[model samples]
Target: MSMDDQVFKRQGFGTDVDLVPPFGLLLVDFVNGFADPGVFGGGNITSAIASSQPLLDYARRCGWPVAHSRIVFADDGADHNIFSRKVPGMLTLREDSHASAIVPELAPIAGELVVRKTVPSAFFGTTLAAWLTQRSVSTLLVAGCVTSGCVRASVVDAMSLGFTPLVVADCVGDRAIAPHDASLFDMQQKYAMVMDRQAALELCDQAAPGN
Candidate 1:
């Protein structure tokens, strides 16, 4: 093992998190702006978005409560915050703007949650938690863009909110590969359960409701 791994293990981090059932799925910021390489995407983001389509379908089939988040600022930049200040370009994601719209492939259907926020975490200042709680979601399957940014933020918030976050590693991506890899490592160690979509699916199936 690497020195960092040994140190983390010695410190008792990266312990296994059990996969409890009544799962929910949160797709964070897989919007047009983030999907377009020229706008806020690149690296493996395209592949991640593609991978999430099947995952979304699977979630729908399982009747899991699914939520999709987009970074939407007001037309007048009314909701700008530290996140927008750090990346001024975030102000361009106005509510009605095309770039702020969730990508076509993984669009939330009727009755599915559509969370709009100016900041990173979908649960921050949003009704996501209440909605998931109403559905009694215990384990949350997470998928989205910018693994080091919104995806990570949502996972942390999900964990903080008492939901077991099962990060679908293949369904989340970053604009930069190094951050993408590092964030996944850190999340796996300290924040959430990080596994590829299939592994997560298998775990979910084993503990599926009524199974």
Candidate 2:
């Protein structure tokens, strides 16, 4: 099936519920490679990263258990997986590679968790689900690059793991506008609560005091 077909099929599942859950943040794959146009980066991803900065600051101030994911492979590509097969250059995101490093603006703090993975979904091979559950994090505020790829995969996994994934629309982007818009629509209709960054921030702020 084509990308559009699969996306539409996913959206047919439907997503409608109240946004009443404890919140945390998950910033996915906002690294140098995704930020540079010459590499994997392009389109509105740059704007998304900028939009995520304030959201990150707010998440920190609210004492949320923030987590970030980087798509890294072993230095020797020994850990390459199906993900790398699609984007072979992903194998270059080694431990010491600058392209793998989280953008300076959204870098994780001392206590925040940094999850490194060779897969799309952050929860697939990581302890992200357990970590959030342990911290009583019921609502996951998601932001990242390439909305149609890692972000969408993570959203599905988040739902499957019983977390309310609120995808910040303006805080996630793709190399092109079409996929970004389409993925946001699919996520809103299916796996997650998709909203603008400002709306998401306000929701988190309101939930913070009680959390």
Candidate 3:
């Protein structure tokens, strides 16, 4: 066996699970501030965003239930939660803030859900789980920013909520290389199937009927 394969075996890690039918896509916090280099964005996030554009188009073409999450506070700041207590900067992402808006390139089309959240996991205190279940989504395809934080949280929550999570490796990034790489490794080992952009695209195409 190869060195990496030996490590995976020793660590009790297995390859990605085969995708279940009726997949859905969840995009977490791909906002302007998170995409720009000057704010909470940098590192490989820009490249991840660029790569995810085609995946988003493919999801639409495949008729998947595509949902997006953004960290939006109430206009008056009355909606502050513990997540903001730990990182007060989260308060800056008020309803009117440009930083909290979903990046224009991946804007939600009509009929798609846009979830406003105050925590890391999109499923925590959000309707994401119910929504996905309603759409009969068996496998959840995830693509977004900050792989170490929101993306990781959402992946764990997706697993806990009984949805198979397939995290597109090239479609999620963090502000730093260390956390990005570590999170990808950990998720691949435990929480989700960490596949590349092409792999995810092909899975979606296969899920589409008569493809």
Per-candidate TM equals: 0.98, 0.91, 0.93
Report the C-alpha lDDT of model 2 over 1-211, residue by residue, as the tens digit. 7777577667665546667656889999999999999999999999999999999998888788899999888988898777789889888888789999999999888999999889888889899999999999888999998899999999999999999999999899899999999888888777899889888777766765655
Candidate that beats the other on lDDT, 1 or 2, i.e. the better one? 1
lDDT of 3 by residue, 1-211 (tens): 8787688879789666778779899999999989988878999989888988998898898788999999988877798888889988888997779999899889999989999898998889889899999999999999998899999999999999899999999999999999998898888888888889897777766766676
| Model 1 regions lying over 4 Å from their true place | none
RMSD of 3: 1.9
Stretches off by above 4 angstroms in model 3 are 1-8
As a whole number from 0 to 100, the lDDT of residue 211 in candidate 3 is 68
Per-residue error for 72 in candidate 1, Å, reads 0.6
Give the winner by TM-score: 1
The clash number for model 3 is 0
lDDT pick, better of 1 and 3: 1
